[model samples]
Target: MGRLPLGVTTLALFFGTQATTGSLETASTVSAAAMIGMAAGAPLQGQLLDRFAKPVVIVCFTVLQVATFVALAVAVNGGSATWTLAVLALCQGMTIPSLPSCTRLVLKRAVSAGEVDAAFALDTTLMEVIYVSGPAIAAGVTATWGPQGLFLGCAVLVAAGTIFFVRVTGARWLGPDPGQAERAPDKEDLRPRPHDSRHWLPAGGFVLAMALLAAPFGLIECALTQFGTEQGTGLSLTGLILSVTGLGSIAGGLAYGTVRWRTGPARRFVVLVLGQGAAITVVAVLPSLGVVWTGLTLAALCTVPLASICFHMLDLLSPPGIWMRMQSWGAVANTGGHAAGVTLGGYIATAYGSGATFALVGLCAFLAIMAAMPALLNPSVRRPEPAKVGAHAE
Candidate 1:
C-alpha cells in the first residue's frame, strides 16, 4: 500500500507536467528534481525516525508527502512555471515516508540471525511484486481518469496504508521498553562503540556498493527507453522488458532466501556484483533485441539477492542505535546513484548510443569493488550473533 501509490505519483508527475507545459525537457527536469530531493532527504529522515517514535515520524511524513502531492497536482494544472513545479516536486520527494527503512529495522528486531536472510529476501521479493503491479495500475488509472485522478488516488492509498501500518505495528510494539533492557543486559556490549571509528568503515563501503549496484539499473532503464525509440518499438515494449526484469528479480530473491548459503554475505555480494557487471556488459554489446531481453533478465537476477545481503549485513554489523540511520543512508546512496545514472545515461544515449550507456555498468561495478575493498579486508568485520529476543521494540 505504501509503495503502490509511488508508481502512480511518479507517472502522474511526469505526464501531468508534460501535458500542462508541452515540454518534455521540463518534465524530465521536474522528475529529476524529485529524485534529488529524495536523495537529500533520506539520511535526515532516517535520523528523525531513529530519534523519534515510529508512528509519530511516519504519520508526520505521510501527511506532508500527501500534501505536497496535492499541491504539485494543483500547481501543474494551474500552468505554473517550471521552477514552481520543480520546487513542489522536490518537496514531495523530500516528504515521502521512510517506510522501507523502518520495515527493515522491524524485521531485524523480529527475526533471528539465521532467518534474517530469508526475511530480507521476502521483503525484496515483495518490493519486486509491488514494482511490477504498481505501474500497470497507474497506467490504467491515468487512462481512465487522467493524471488528476491518479494523484488523488495515490494520496488516498498512501494515507490508508500509513494509518493501517501505524495502528497494527505502532500500538503493539513501541521502541525498546524498560523490560527489554532488563531481558538483554548485554545489548549495549553488542552495539558498536562510539569511539571505534573502524566500525563505520563498512557502512561507508556499503553505501558506495549500493550506489554502484543501483547505477546500472538507472542507466539501463534510460538506455533501454532510448533504444526502444530508435527501434520504433515505443514505450510499451520498453515497459514490458522492464517488467520481465522485475520477474527475474522476484525469482532470484525467492530462491536466494530459501537457501542456506555456505559463504558469508560479503563473499556472496562480491560475486553477485561482478557477475551482474559482466552480464550487463555482454548484453549491452549485443545489437539484437532478443539478446537484450534475455541478457537483462539474467543480469537482473542478481539485484534482489544483492539487496537482501546488504540489508542482512547491516543488521549484523550496525549498532542498534544508529541502524535506522545506516539503512537510510543506503536509501540515499541508491537514490543518488539512480539520479546520476539517469542523467548521465541520457547524455550518453543521445550523443553516443544506447549501447554505450550500458558499458558504464561494468565500470561502476569495478569502482564499487575498489571502494569496498577496505571494509571487505577488515578483520573486525565478521558475522555477529543474532538479536536477543525482546531486545528491541518497533
Candidate 2:
C-alpha cells in the first residue's frame, strides 16, 4: 500500500524536481540511490526480523525512513550537493517497507488456507491498482501542492501505515503459525534441504528472471516521462500513461488467475516474459505516445501474471523457515533489475533520447528472456500452478 504509492511518488518527484536542480542527471542519480537502497534494504530487514521483535524492527526503520525522506526532500529542494541527495536517498531506501511480502505472510493469520489464494489474488490485484493510481495521485498532489508537499505526504503515509501495521494487530500478526511445529526458525531450514548448494541454481535462476522482467519497467518509467516532455504534453500526463498500463495489468492478472495452464509454471514463465519483450520492443519502434501506450498496455498485461507465477514457483521451491529470506531475495532481484534499468535508462535518455533508450531496454529484456530459457528448464524448479492462480492449478 504505502510502498507502491511511495515508489511512484518518488518517480514523480525525480522527474519533476529536475527543474529546480541543475540537471536531470542529478535527479536521476538521486532516484538511483534510492533504487540501490531498495535493492538491498528489504533483505536486510528480513534478516533483522529473524532475530528481533517484528514491531521493534519496523518502528526503528519507519522512523529512519521518515527522517531520510525529509532530508532527501530538503536536499533536492535546497540545491544541496547531488552526492548528499543521493546518499540520503540510499538511506531512505534501506527503510522502505516490503509491504507486498508482509501482506502475503500475514494473510494466513487473517484467513483460512483454502481462501489464502483468493486473498493473494485480491492482494496482488489491489496492489496493481494502487500502482496504477500512484503516478496520477502524485501528479495531482504535486500540481495542487508541490513536489515538497508530495514528499511530505509520502512520509506521513509511510509512517502511519507502518505504525498501524505493526501496533494495531500486535504479536499474532508477526508470530509463527501455530500448526507448523516442524518449521523451526533456523537459517539452515530456509534452504531447500539436502541440497544446500543445489538450491542456488534455482534461486539464482529466479533472481535473474525477476531482474530481467523488472528492468524494462524501470526504464519505461523514465522513458515515458521524457517522451511526454519532448512531446510538449508534460511529465504529469506521462504519469497518467502509466496508470493506463496498470489498468491493462489488472485485466491481465485477473485473466491469468482464471486460466489454468496445461503446462508447469516454468513453461508459462517463458511464454509471458517473451511476450513482454516483444511488446517492449514494439514500444521502441513506435513514434506516437498513443502507440507507445498501446504497447505499454500490452507489456503491462504480461507483467503481473508472470511475476505472480515466479513468486508462486519460488514459494513451492523454498524450504519452510526461510520463506522471509526467499521472498526478500526475490525482492532484491526485482529491485536490482529496476535500479539498473532506471539508472541506465536515465543516462541514455539524457544522452540520446527516449526512443534509443526504449530500444536498449527492449533488447536487454529480449536477451534476458533468451538467457532465462535454459534456467527455467531446470528440473528442481518445476512446480504446479500457483495456489492463487486458476482453480485448475496443481
Best by lDDT: 1
**Model 1 agreement with the true structure over 187-224: per-residue lDDT tens digits:** 44443454468778766887887888778877998889
What's model 1's lDDT at 60?
94
* Prediction 2 global C-alpha lDDT: 0.70
Where does model 1 exceed 4 Å of error? 171-191, 226-237, 285-287, 378-394
- In order of appearance, the predictions have TM-scores of 0.88, 0.77
Please report the candidate that would top TM-score against the real structure. 1
Q: What are the lDDT figures for the candidates, one per model? A: 0.76, 0.70
